[model samples]
Target: MRISAVRTADRFLPERLSRQLNPWLLRLDQMLDGSTEHAVAQRVSLIAFLVRIISAAIALVSQVIFARWMGQFEYGIFVLVWVTVVILGNLSCLGFQTTVIRFVPEYLERQQLDHLRGILFTSKAFALGLTTCIALIGAGGVYFFREAIESYYVVPFLIGFICLPMIALGDTLDGTARSRSWVLVALTPTYIIRPVLTLVVMSIAHAAGFAPTATAAVTSAIIATYTTTLFQLLVVNHRFQAVVVPGTKTIRFGEWFAVSLPIFLVEGFFFLLTNADVLMVGRYMEPDKVATYFATVKLLALVHFVYFSVKAGAAQRYSELMHTHDHAQLSQFARDTARWTFWPSLMMAIVLLLLGKPLLYLFGAQFTDGYPLLFVLVVGVVARASVGPAESLLNMAGKQKICAMVYAVTLIVNICLSIVLIPVYGLAGAACATAFSMVFEAVTLALTVYNRLNITMFVFAGRTNARPVKEEI
Candidate 1:
């Protein structure tokens, strides 16, 4: 009916507008048909892009409110602790969050329901258990070093530890949902619901006369994280039961871990590479400066989300193509993803840079000082975007060890450069360090993909010869 309507409208529409509308309508029709791999990936990428847009708005609003309510110092403290918790929570998954994306599609392709059920259950359990242990260790560490830690950060850091298990669980569920192309289910809990809930909880606490301190913000976060994750657990499990029949589960712990550990190293290094600048700035600079730098990074998320949205949508497709051994399709899709990632990122970076100083001023006037850092940081972001999610491709294709090695080397460069530059040049130094490391990461990953798979992963690369396929899954 919709197609009929579109056809009818196309007959009456002016040629100029119809030229524009026709291509998009045709693409929509292709997506609605859902027969081709390219169409499916495009649809999924569109959904992920929309979700990230909404999430970015919510996060921006929430961060601005927190900055206003707590002032720069307290907000900085809260940002530092919260970043720590999130990083640790994601790390505690030990790569199961991502490994699920690789294995679930392959298992289903082979009609291995037992393995599918096994992974779904095991990933969540492993994440919850590991994160819980990490949380306990974190609490103990805080207790043992309370006196040595800053008086203001101690309690908030302890409170932040309580959020780890839930955060980890949410991440695993996110991957599980993504593996099935449930974009809303995959992204909503952590990205949309959690930030909104945090703001609401914090607002209520403040209205009730609670002090707007780092501790209060962390308390609100704890409540929000638990609420979001438990609800996600119920929804995800219910959806899983509907799709996967009840049966005996097969737990392939050894095989899963063998893949996961290298992926863990890749992710751990990637996370540290991305966030090390902020952490180092926090270490050397005062809270206000930290707050300023954090705000700049948050503003940059508008541009960064393009890469993430593409990665989230593209990973499962990469795994599927690998399973099918369709090298031609895989090569085309990989190049398509790089184009999808780079152009939008370039546009968003330009728009954000135009509005960046004003956006930082929304956090506080002093934040405008960090606006110049945006120019430096965006170079690396665009550089990384030039390769799209080639790393995801590598991981799904059983090249995780090499990918991990690439990220590890990039991270070392980032850390060493940051250590030397941040103390000397402050935020600008950190930005330079991060951007340079990103360039290094992108070049290395592109070369790795080319060398191992004979596929050029860069956006601007021309067409190439297709390689003979010998591997079978």
Candidate 2:
């Protein structure tokens, strides 16, 4: 009997050890199988967080390779031009990217298939047409103003413009996938595939005798953008076909435009605000300095992506909850998201800062100069995370105008601060400017959410009153 009991204990020991060792797997299984709306949102956020973590690693590695290959000056030029192009590409979508997130869920919930088909088609067509026009005009502007522009930037700018239409299309498709909670499909193309492809293509170009210059880098970007966007377009279309029944397409251009325009302002200012420091640094400093600053930013990407992941997962849920008039539940979920964002962000920021110098050194020994900037920049990232995705919640609740106003004001402050600070204090000044602006943004957003939705969204806030919304969202 004693021998038999010992055998039984031995058999159960591994099972007990597995449960203790991999509790997260058990939680993941629960998240996967749970039927509640919160469960789905949680699952999406977890998946997105994991995806962003992987993408951040890929991006960091690719960037290190690029810096090693092109050196700091060329890499800096590529970074500035590419960042500018990405901001414009998102703007060229004219708010349709988020507009779809707002409307698609509503349409699906209402079983409005015609409207769904109309929006899906309209968002894509509008993004392509509008961005194409922007690209052409931008190209002409660049040519006409060529003499006035810095010579090194001119060709890269032109090459980068080629990516505009495709970038906008990719963003729209990302939103399309996000609206349906297809988190992996929404994020992978932009975050994972595009960066990897750009690296591979750039390496190929260099191997084929193309110069290791910004022009070659931008050219690789063009090819990768086109390929990734087209691939995403096809995949998104397939997903839609499987779920959405075929029917006559409705065209509500006027209505969609009305919605998209304000969102465009909100998002446009938001992107500009987000990238303003980088742009300002480029304006006031040399390429090597820009490279160092950008490298620091890249190191911080792990912390920053936590907020983005939560924002991506929470927006559509916010839209559904708002429309349902589940104010109490919405308030609770908002607080939950704030927690989700802040804790992980705070944790990652600690880890990143602890390893900051070593990580920056990976970019190159010269790049290690960026280590000091991480301390200032991380404060802003964590501050922003404290409010979760307040803008997304507002926008989804149809409070875009107010949100746009808040962002516009915040952007103005960021630009003014960057301009005033970068020339005087250099990179440290830019870091301070960005960090201060983020704090301002967070406080303002928290106030706006409380005023508009009667929900407290701060990370440390207690249970909200859940009062009735003062007006239509």
Candidate 3:
């Protein structure tokens, strides 16, 4: 009897240990095993999640190094200039990035290769041309406003504008890759390669005796952006060649612009809403404070990546599912994604907050001052995650105008709150305002999703009675 009991214990112990140790492996196996919508979504989400994990690590390390190299004041200037350039570059895509995702899947579904080819070429060309124009206008504005701007910011800002065309092109390429479900190809160049290249270039410059200033850093970024973007463009074109084949193309500029403009509004508002806090902080505080706040926000990015990863993988899938009229599957998937976003985000938030001070210290001891703001900021990030990527759902479902309206309101609230509070409470006030805006944005988005699609978008929402809705397209 003793021998038999020992055998049973040995058998159960190993099995239990395997189950406990390799749960993610088991989940991964499930994800890759089938061709079902859920399975595909899971696989893409997992890939995107992993990519973000790597990107986050790379970005964190790079930012730390940059902060150390440039010191607080220069780092602050670089960050502010870079952030403004990035935001403008993305906006200059003029919604073509997301518009391509919406249109590509449908074009392929309908076997409209001509339309697909047209969009592939048109989006890049449109983004490049439009961004160039915007860049020129930005340069002119900088020239005219040079006297009014801070002397330190003027040169870097001018240099950063040179990156606009490439940034817009990169964004459009990302959309094309995503629509085709090429997750690695879609994400790797922009997220992984670009930052790595930026660090390498900056290090080389510093070694060559370039002063570790905002101008040097911005120059490195411009070089990195152009290099990464051009390389990405080549690779993407190569892939498209094999899959799409050569054919006569058609351009539907008027129709495409009609759809794209509203999407532009949506994305524009979202970008502004997300970055208004930083900009407002820069407006109200000194470079040292900006450095502290930016460092803290970078730490919080560890949590924010979860939502972005899920959204990146899920957007094309949402478009595909909507086109197929699979209301049931779409609703279920929406709920699943919300769960995917919230739990990981919640866990990350907890971990980041617990370790917040130490992580901020990595940037520098002074940065540790921003640690307390993490608690205030995490609430908003977690709240945004609670609704998952419902905005993507609405945009894919042809509710972009309404989605644009929601974001517009949220941006207004964020800006107003930031302006009102930053003067009073400083960094903490900025955090509070941003968090409140996030909560407001999440609630409005959740209600919009429920009312329009009959899908409960919140993480805690019950099973939805998903009825077939008329396709906006």
lDDT of 1 by residue, 316-373 (tens): 8998888888788888888989999999999999999899998888988888999999
lDDT of 1: 0.90
Q: Which stretches of candidate 2 lie over 4 Å from their true place?
A: 1-29
lDDT per residue as tens, model 2, 1-473: 12333344446668776546455554555567645788788989998999999999999999999998889999999999999999999999989999999999888888999999999999999999999999999999999999999999999998888899999999999999999999989999999999999999999998999889999989998998899989998899999998797889999999999989889999999999888888999999998899999999988889989999998889989999988999999999999999999999999999999999999888899998889999999999999999999999988888889999999999999989888999899999999999999999999999999998988999999987767787754
The TM-score that candidate 3 achieves is 0.94
Error of 2 at 10 (Å): 17
Off by over 4 Å in 1: 1-9, 14-24, 469-473
lDDT of each: 0.90, 0.91, 0.90
What TM-score would each prediction reach against the true structure? 0.96, 0.94, 0.94
Model 1: how large is the Cα RMSD against the reference?
A: 2.0
Highest-TM-score candidate: 1
Error of 3 at 217 (Å): 0.5
Candidate closest to the true structure, highest lDDT: 2
In model 1, how large is the Cα lDDT of residue 58? 95
Worst window of 10 by summed lDDT in candidate 3? 1-10
